[model samples]
Target chain A: MTVSDIQKLLNAKVLSCNEKLNMEVTNAFASDMMSDCLAFAKDANVLITGLCNPQVMRTAELLDIECIIFIKGKEPTDSMITLAQNNGICVLMSEYCMFETAGILFKTGEIGGATVGC
Target chain B: MAADNTIKLHYDVPNDDFTRAGEASSDLKGKLKQMGISPDAIRKVSIALYEGEINMVIHANGGYIDAEISENGLKLVLCDTGPGINDIVQATQAGFSTALEQTRMLGFGAGMGLPNMLQNTDDMIIDSIVGVGTTITMFIKM
Candidate 1:
């Protein structure tokens, strides 16, 4: 799936990197804990999180995640937007809560956990 | 152990500043990407070093990071003067953390930092003194 698809599905607003909305993302991981996200988020291109700290952007940079979807109307600060822009990551904010967002994406088959062996 | 081809970078981590914890790692990631390093290698180095950087800020008050990059691999050494880990074995275990409750609220201190570091690197070594400090050396192969 793509960032555009996620935006349409969740009715999310593009906070940064709007030009890259068409970018393709294969998988996603939803978590508030940066540690857990860092440990198990292999090959996941989208991060669904409620944490608004700069570390979220840092984690996305480290993992090469393409987009960050902040749930429950959580907005990212200017620094976070600047960081995401510098890293070429798209930031989206959704009014839905974390659980509902994850469920919607999963039901649409646009996002899911890490896939095991081929 | 300095080689002619090595590119070394250094940074000093500040205490209790969760907002700025990953600056060093972010800088290193950009440098590696500019050098045309493989994405896989860069990802490994980024995750491993970033985790170590966060650990330094969370556990060790603050610290220093020295990263040496060569054609073959990247070597990252993080040294801190904070309270040292009391148990290396337990510390390496997943879900075992000593971080304050406040730290956890910021979406960290889940006890996966060390394990995540080890998982992303080719080699790792930890040395610590109870009251002196802790130093972690991690190598990510290119």
Candidate 2:
């Protein structure tokens, strides 16, 4: 699905990256732990996270992720938004909790990309 | 390829600050890119080193990272004065973290830092003296 599709599905506003709405993303990773995201996430373009910090953007930057969907009704701070804007990363907000948000995305056919070998 | 020209960058890890973690790795990533290093190599080194940086801040109470850039690859030497690991085998085990509740609330201490570093890098060496400190060296081929 695309960022536009997620926006419509969750009734989330396009806080940024309106231009890249058509970009297709095959998978999604939802985690509060930035290290886990960095360690295992590969080829997933959308990050569903509840953590509101600059390191979120930095982690997304390292993975080259294009979209960040903030779950748990959490809105990023102005500084966080500015960082996302500067990084050209699309930002969105969902009222769903992390688990619910992930469930919705997974039910909608966005499967987990790959598991980090234990 | 030709003879390697070494470029070393040192960063003093500040354990008091959780918000400032990963600064060194980000800076190193930018430097490697500016030097025209390949993207694949940069990604490997960035992820591996960033994990180490985060670990140092979380567990070691601060430390130092020395990144050596060369034609062959990027080599990172991370040393920390924090209480050393008591059991290397157990520490390397996933989900075995001693980070406090606050650190986990901040979305860290999942116990994947070391294993993740090992997974991302081509070579990894860890040496530790309990109660003294720990040293980790990792290399990613360019």
> Local distance difference test, per candidate?
0.89, 0.83
Query: What is the DockQ for all candidates, taken in turn?
Result: 0.90, 0.66
At residue A118, candidate 1 shows an lDDT of 19
lDDT of 1 at B78: 95
**CAPRI class assigned to model 2:** medium
The alpha-carbon deviation from the true structure for residue A55 of candidate 2, after best TM-score superposition, in angstroms, is: 2.5
Cα displacement (Å) at residue B38, model 1: 1.5
**DockQ score for model 1, please?**
0.90
Off by over 4 Å in 1: A115-118
Tens-digit lDDT track of model 1 for B1-142 = 3478788889999887888999898888888899898898888888888889899888888889998887778888899998998999999999999898988988889999999999999999999999999999988888
- The residue pairs that clash in candidate 1, if any, are none
lDDT (C-alpha) at residue A3 in model 1? 92
Cα TM-score of candidate 1: 0.94
True contacts kept of 1: 1.00
